[model samples]
Target chain A: MSATATIYLLTAAAVFGIGVYGLLQARQILRQLLAINLMGGATFLLLITLGGGADGPPDPVPQAMVLTGIVIAVSATAFALALLVKLQDATGSSDLDPPDAE
Target chain B: MIALAMDAIIAIGLVWLALRTVRGANVFSAIIMFIVFGLIMSLAWARLHAPDLALAEAAIGAGITGALLLVTWRRLQVLEGSVPQVGAETRSLWLTLPTGLAAALLIAGLGWVALSLPAEPATAGELAWQRLPEMGVSNPVTGVLLGFRAYDTLLEMGVLLAAWLGAQVVASEHRPGALPGPAHEEVPLVGALLSLVVPISLLVAVYLLQAGGSAPGGAFQGGAVLAAGGVLLCLTGRLEAADQASLIERVVLILGLAVFSGVGLVMLPLGEPMLAMPGVWAIYLIETALLLSIALTLVLLFAAAPGLRRRL
Candidate 1:
């Protein structure tokens, strides 16, 4: 692989790891959502890197897939936020855990 | 050499921003960092030679998502009567360490496999390129989306519609309406800005739709640009959510899926395969419908309403 691709692949790996950590460690549902999105971004980068390789025009198949994925991600995010708003309205807290748990 | 250096910097920035977005001092900061992450990732897409993706990432990933996040944060503040501090409560490290380590190992393994794959292996991408002429679209991505993988594109529209419906279901009894924004009637520039920006965005969206036949633009990108205009109007209080959708709004909302599946299924009695568009005309028809539907769907999602109306 080209050095550029290698560098990006490694970056993707690291970002994925960070996302995983965030998802595990976050207390707030919104924070977890952000982490999930981070993980999704990492996967997109990795997929495109794999498709593009070192030279020639980048592949369109993966590009189209990523485009679709981006739209889907936003849709899911918006729905999740809507759910989050309702959760906050009902429970008066953004955290997933109930107050009595502590 | 300089290009390599730029890539390295972007890679580092992405990793850093991802970390910060997760571990920032507060929820507000984390959200901001996430937006910044989206912006930088778009730059990375450009560097990776995917201009279509770059445009999508900047507009949808960063712009719309960031706006949604900020709005949610504001809502949380309103509910609690104060800005909630994220990351204030600490979790036990014992549970975190093993999970984090396992995830890191999993990613490392995936990366190793990705790197170990042979270079230039024949892929569906190559096949799509070979068959591009039959699709009648010069843009390979557009060809794959509308022609070769039309099923995926079709389902994606369903997903968008489903999401909007889901949002409407989950929306609280707040009577979704225009978000309280700076209604600066005193600023003469606001009117000038709207007059210029809205029309320009419309022009750009049309140009993108037309260009998709031969270039990097397409229905999704054009739709996003158009939605940005709607979002601008919402922010400036030119638009507001209504309790019920107007008849025109309801029809336009379903136009994409309706036109797409209508044309696709109509080919069945003629003995053509499902979703096999007849010609360039059919492709443009579906795409135009898709552009309108996508723009409306996204704007409604951002607005979090069953319907929208002009603010008088």
Candidate 2:
């Protein structure tokens, strides 16, 4: 693999790990969403990096999939945000559980 | 040398900002960092020779998603006066340490396997590139999306539309007005800025849609740009939420799926395979429909409303 691919591949791994940690550690729904998005980014990076090398243009298939993934992420995120707002409205709290939960 | 340096910088930036984005001093700051991270990611995309992905990342990933997040944050604030921040869940060191070690091992394994995997000589990617000429779209990515993988694109549009519809079903009906944007008085320059920016964004959106067939731009990027224009109008108070969607609004919302599927299914009767683009013109037709639907869906999602209309 090219140095560029190696750099991003490792980065993608670390980023995914961090995202897992974030998801586990998060207290708010919004933070969890952010963490999820971070993981999504890592996956996209990994897919594209693996799709091509340093020498030539990347594969169009992965590029198209990643592009589609980006759109779906935003849609899911937007819908999740809307749900978050409503959750706040109905329950009067934005955290997954009440802030007092152990 | 400089290219490698830039790559390293972006990679490091992504890691650092990602860390901050998840566990910053506050959620608001985390959001800001995430937006920055997205912008840097676009740089990474460009460096990777995926200008198509780069444009989509900037406009949709950073621009639309960031705006949605900020607006959601504001709504949370307005509802509760303050969003509670509980610090990271406290856990025993015994548990945390072992889990951390496992995660490290997992990541190492993933990276190792991914890097070590042998490149297949004749992959789907190679096939797609080889078939690009027959697909009628000059751009391979466009060919893959609208030609080879039309099903995926159609499903993506369905997901976007469903998300918008889901948001409508889930949103509290109490707020008929657009979920509050930053308060802005109608300054004279605001109008002047709108006159210039809105039209320019519209023009750019169309340009992107046109260029997408043969170049990097496409329905998603163009739609996001157009949505940004709609967002600008919303922020400046030139648009307001409606209790229900107008007929035109509803029609435009479904145009992408309707037109795309219509064109695809029509192929079967003619003995052509499903979703086989009859020609470049069909791509243009579908992209325009997709551009309209995507732009409207995003604007509605950002607006968090069933519909929007001129402020008058």
Candidate 3:
């Protein structure tokens, strides 16, 4: 009910929406990666905010999970980027497929 | 009250930036924005009383992730003129608008529910708190990470190592051109800055690892501070990436996981719990190794170079 909590939640929602939008609109493989990362960031924010209390130590579980999530996200992102480079090298196109198809 | 308001505003700004990064017109700009967003999120975590998360997010999220993005962006730039194909599946207004609204509604509902939940007995946090004395650390988060829920942390490190291996498998033989080359004669101000920052980073990193047993600092924070030092050198062109990793570099990279696993495996025959570090000394030792490895891995990942070497 605090205005601060409301702001964090709303921002997180908007970020998720944009990530969804990017996943739809981006034509480049790299762009898609960015979108996915953005979505991940949004989720992290949501978790942290939700864990926060009006007057207590924040929920330790979500904080721990988010720490774990950040590591996972970076590792996965690095692997994905490496793969993207390889894919482009193997194929002439950085864009794997055209935007017309779902 | 003011602190809460400030934290809330910053958090909102971060989310807004995340959205902008995703939907931005220029891909490069979006990546930059995303890094900034990650940095702000680190601040938010600090405000929310999750210093461990703050440290990890800043290092892995903003630092390592940003490096990965920039490297990929550069590689894609090799194919000039032609735009990299993005996935073009557009959502209908009926789909997108509603989804957005629904997510908002869900988050708001969840937040309210969470706020309303009565603090009760038998909370898991309480259990962790109760057991902290046994873990030999005052920090509950550290206790959870290295004591109670240590399996998660162990698996998380595995994920990091696996990702590194995966990257190696997919690595391009044609090395990306190092943007900043080493300078023989130290430039004015730059050298002074390096002298100041590098030592400070090292101090902070060690302090973090040592303090983690009782405070917000830990291996992740320490590693990041170390990596920041590495990054400083890289930016100043004082460091160079080699075709092969040196013996020392390899040792540092493997040290953390090795010590941790070795201790755990060794203790198995001794009739001790797996990864149940014997004392605060073991915890510090394991953390030292982990901190070194984490720092090395992140720095190498950032440079996108197989091995880092001192500039001759």
Model number with the top DockQ: 1
**In candidate 1, what are the lDDT values of residues B193-296, reduced to their tens digit?**
99999999899999999998898788998999999999888888888878878898899899999999998998899999999989999999999999999999
Q: Rank the candidates by DockQ, best first.
A: 1, 2, 3
Q: Which structure is stronger by TM-score: 1 or 3?
A: 1
How far residue A60's Cα lies from its native spot in candidate 3, in Å, is 2.6
Give the distance in Å from residue B269's predicted Cα in candidate 1 to where it truly belongs: 2.2
lDDT tens per residue, model 3, B1-312: 788678667866876786677566677888899889888988877776777887877877887788778866766676433664554433346666765666566656655655565544436676777778997888878777777777787787778777777777777787543334643666798989999999999998889898998988788778878988987888688888788888998788778778888877777888987888788787787888888888888787767677888777
Off by over 4 Å in 2: B82-102
Shift of residue B306 alpha carbon in model 2, Å? 0.6
> Model 2, residue A58: what's the lDDT?
76
What is candidate 3's CAPRI-style docking category based on DockQ?
Answer: acceptable
lDDT of 2: 0.88
- lDDT: the better of candidates 1 and 3: 1
Candidate 2, residue B35: how far the Cα is off, in Å = 0.8
**Residue-level lDDT tens digits of model 2 in A46-88:** 8888888444667888899999999999999999998898888
lDDT at residue A3 of model 1 (Cα atoms): 89
Real interface contacts reproduced by model 3, as a fraction? 0.56
